[model samples]
Target: MSEATASPGLPSRLLADPEMVSACAARDFAQIFQLAKRRGGFHPSRIARACELTPSRVGEVMRGKPKITTMDVIERIADGLRIPGHMLGLADRSWERPAVPEQRQPTAVARPVQEDRPVAAGASGDLDEILAVAAGTRVTPTMLRSLQASIEDYWRHDDEHGGEALRPAVIGQLKYVKGILRDTADPAFRHSLHGIAAELARLTGWTYFDARQHSAARGYFTESLRLAREIDDRPFIANVLACLSLQATYQDKAEDAVTLARAAQDSARLDGGTPRLLAMLYMREAFGHASAHDQAATYEAIGEAQHHFGRIAPSDDDPAWLQYFDHTKLTVDTGIALGQLGDATAAEPLIAEALRAEPTANLRGRAFHTFWLARTQLQGLKVELACTTAGQALDLAAIVESPRVVAHLREFRRSLKPYRHTPAAMELVSRITELGS
Candidate 1:
């Protein structure tokens, strides 16, 4: 097998040692650090920072006084140290293989995206040459355009098949694009790269949310916001904030949802997004208010959304990302808000209309909207209709791979207890049981 390259100042023998490479790949930091300090002239403090650990902690691990736990910390250390993910028993490193064959770098060097320093703990020789060689593999606008296309393609797949099926691949793509961003130099290109990175992060967050991985989703959303701020991309920031708020709404954190939605709307107003984008934020605010049981505020926000949406025109400057927010989407969101606020009468027709117009390509969305429509049916005491509508959602759920959809179906099953004597309800219950949680 070909040996991995050694960090500057580290002995070639260490990198070549099978045992040492195995320790690093296994994330046995204690063993790796012990060997580094004794045989590689490595500095603990520098390694500590690279791993995002305190020097004392690094020492404790080296001395076997403490064990490094937490997959997050381990992954960070492996990434910061430029340990190939495949070596660490994870996916291939973003640099080891390009996301697309055309974007591959010419050099073998794989640098960390965040830190500019070399991977060596204390190496100090000709760092500029390494960076220059790495930078020579420039990411042009055409390359970024391909990346954007890939992201859109993933979105389509996520819409059809749900996030669980695509999370690993989408995240891998994000990592690869992020690596490219690190090597980019042109100011305009870097700014564009940041925009794409922010969107990728946001998409990753959405996928995590769909998978019911709330903590992971929140982390990615926060990262997206930070990347958006780096480029001062207000529209992207607003969209990310709206996504956070939507997650909060789904989790029943009404106050947090309202606060985040308000922030998103404020961001859009201050930073100048299109009317359609502003409308989408307003609709998000409506959902937050509905979740809070604030009927007055919910309708008011819904009205605002309608007002803003009415201002849209064919000549509007909406980006391609805003294409998902058309009239049908507005109707679906409004119906959801109304349903949440205990207005089944008003919500049912609107939701049904949107569901009817929903294309077959958007299976995940159709499942989601169907759930709301069933909820509205249940609210109206139409148990038979509700059971049938929910059955439709359950059928879709069986095909799509979203934890959120499963969660909704589970909740729907629980709601059927009141109508257990009804044959339709019992039939639906049997189907749900067969589907499994």
Candidate 2:
């Protein structure tokens, strides 16, 4: 028998190997495709068509081309093939392929040995040691305050400096703070750590969201919420809930988005009100309504969000995590809601202002705004501009290793099919389509 026909069947092997079985049962398309292709006999062309992929893509995958197949694409392919979705490795809807572990490089600082002794209760013992360690590592109150100020500055002027430029420093400080928190044993110290973790998670989520790695972003947001809950930090919990609501909206889970947003609002209400959190929750609710095509509800929510946001006082003691909320952020979200509501005309000015207000360094936000602009332009039949904007978004997306950004690009490619005959549009679409290979 020829090698292709002689190979073991996926079903038999799936029953034997736990990993393969688990992967199959989870509807993990990447693993299923890998195993199926290895077994051979099945024609690549047929598989490609079944998966809604181009014939060329089948050849690339069969030939082991250097391409990244997104989990969503794999799920779509599995759906198309009428495979038992659970067998394809989608058991955990939140399952994500872990990022490739980075090689550990030697650090400039000396590493400390892990201690087994439990920290003594109170401000003495381990707490004192932890504080001393933090001080040695320059993680003092002054340092944290300064870092916080820098982060705020970065957010405020991200349009000018570009988001990438601030990432290294922000991540560095976050890592440093995380280490300090993890090594501490005092209840008060742990509480402070929880606050820091929540904030870091938010930043990480934003970074991942910008990169278009929705799954990873969701994971970070989930962790952030967990941290806030551990600390009983009501405002932070509401903020994290708002983040989750946005994720649900983006993934087309409109009802879930609304539910989460309302929950966030209620949580904030119980905490005596946080205008920023309330505004974010209302804005997300508006987006959810827009996604559901409930125009009246969408408009009502948007008005509520705007009124609350306007009521935020400069003198009010807002939580550190809500520092990013501003008029510019509101405009961007409003534009997105308007676009979803099918009011492209109304969305245009707000999107434009958002783009103009966004810092050049905020590459991720720029990419997002540009992508939405492309969507709006495409809906309006401005094919050339849409193509150009999508191309720009693709360029920015490439610089960040984000799955969420990739997903957006994938959707944008789908929306560009009507203009595939146009060279510029087709070229842009081709690049994004190539990702699934």
Q: Assess the local accuracy of residue 125 in candidate 2 as a C-alpha lDDT between 0 and 100.
A: 71
TM-scores for every candidate against the unseen true structure: 0.69, 0.59
Best by TM-score: 1
How many clashes in each candidate?
Answer: 0, 32
Report lDDT (CA) for all predictions. 0.81, 0.70
Candidate 1 per-residue lDDT over residues 76-157, each given as its tens digit: 5655455666656776644456546477557777765867754653444557657656654466434665777788898999
Give stretches of model 1 more than 4 Å off.
1-136
Question: Which one wins on lDDT?
Answer: 1
247-323: candidate 2 lDDT, tens digit per residue: 88877899999999999898888766667778888998998999999999999999999999988764344654566
Give me the overall lDDT of model 1. 0.81
Clashes, model 2 = 32
For model 1, what is the error of residue 437's alpha carbon versus the real structure, in angstroms, after optimal superposition?
5.2
